[model samples]
Target: MAAAYEELDRDSFAALTLDRLARRSGVHVSTIRRRWRTVEGVVVELLAERSSMLPTPDTGDFRRDLTQLTQAIADFNNALRNRNVLQGLLAAAAHDPRVEEIVRAAFVRRIEEVTLIARQAVERGEIPEDTDPREVIAALAAPLYYRVLILRGSIDERLVHTTVETTYQATVAGVFVRKESREGNRKGDREG
Candidate 1:
């Protein structure tokens, strides 16, 4: 069943109808129809498994944490290159609402994992407590997604590292400025 799903993923199940999948898997059309839910299930499982392999940082430094996180993402992209299964899912997601749901779930899981890492940084005092974990994760993710999906550019280690560093600095600076402004406002009110 796993092998059959893998084949379907590489060939893009979107391009293959249920009858075609049954023919390719040497199963009956009714079997394919009955197992349709399993196909999405298997893909989601695979995505979760891959996401679980992402590195978590205990370095107690925001820079090192960001570097490690970016490197993990780079490694993930490299690993995904050999797995044609994801490409098939991407193609299917273009047209199938069920596949899209699975894809979205996978993405949410990835973001949640990143958020946990960022929250750890907050606990360690590497970032301000007011910083939203979701924003930190998004900062790291947005550029990579844009380059990969929009520009169709390579997601290399250097690019990932640079994006993380740049975003971290900018975000931290913005936080500092906001904090200073709030302090100034409080002081002004006290004087008045």
Candidate 2:
């Protein structure tokens, strides 16, 4: 399946068929159908498999960790095939509920895995304890996604530097503190 995907251009990927995949993979169409149900399902599974290879960096320094994470993201997005797979999957997700569910669950799992960096940063006293790991990670990644998925732009070193530095600064400044923490602080202020 990956071979089939590799042979096709980004535009052709969206139109990929089970028969084409079966021919490329030498698996029966029935087997492919039974396993993945649809082309989008197969692609999403491939995405889950491929994206898991991205390491969650833990350099014990938050800034270094963020830099590693950003570089990994930039490297992943720089690959035309990875970008094609993501574009195909997201386009499918918009129209297909089952694909959407699978994609969403996969992303949630990845996010949970990657948020460990922020959790470690908190443990290392690099960021406020009240910082929300998910929010911090999201801020770090959102611009990259916007650049690749929305603007169809290439990943550049400058973008990686800006994203890492911005996220790191905001995190250390308590910008990503949990809402519960913010509310508690507000209550304390009122009482004081």
Candidate 3:
């Protein structure tokens, strides 16, 4: 099964049929077809496995946390290496709702993990509690995504640090004011 999936990265699945995968795996075609929901399932599983190998941050600093997140994304893109695989999968996703669902779920899982780290920063007062963790993470990640996927640029450590620092400062400035205003309102309520 693994060998078949590895071969998939080298060639398009459209070119490699179920019979070929079964032959490569030394399993019957019906066996492979029965267990896997879609041919993409094997690929999705490979992606999920790769994602599991990413490092988690425990640095206690928001900037460091953001940097780690950005690095993980860069690492993921680097590991994939084959940009055509991603493009092909995305093209398939446009026509197949199941592929789209899997892709969306995978992305949500990754984003939520980053959000949890930002939430921890809020709890530790590294950032204001009113700061939306999701927004903060998006600010850090969106540019990296745009640079890599849209702009066809690189993901360097310097870019990661700059984006993380900028997002952290901007998020603190925006959210801290809201926190102060809310506190003031509470104090006024108590006095009244």
Give the best candidate by lDDT: 2
lDDT of 3 by residue, 155-184 (tens): 777877788778878877765334444455
What's the lDDT for residue 40 in model 2?
A: 84
The local distance difference test score of each candidate is 0.64, 0.84, 0.68
Candidate 2: segments with Cα more than 4 A from true spot: 8-11, 185-192
Model 3 misses residue 181 by how many Å? 8.5
| TM-score attained by model 2 | 0.91
Please list the residue runs of candidate 1 whose C-alpha ends up more than 4 Å from where it truly belongs after superposition. Answer: 1-41, 80-83, 175-192
Would you list the clashing residue pairs of candidate 1? Answer: none
lDDT of 2 by residue, 1-192 (tens): 575566454445666888888877788999999988888878887788878999999888999999999999899878887888888888998998988898889988988899999999888888997787888888988999999989999889999999999999999999988766666754432212
The local lDDT score (0 to 100) that residue 86 gets in candidate 1 is 58
Candidate 3 residue pairs in backbone clash: none
What lDDT score goes with residue 28 in model 3?
Answer: 83
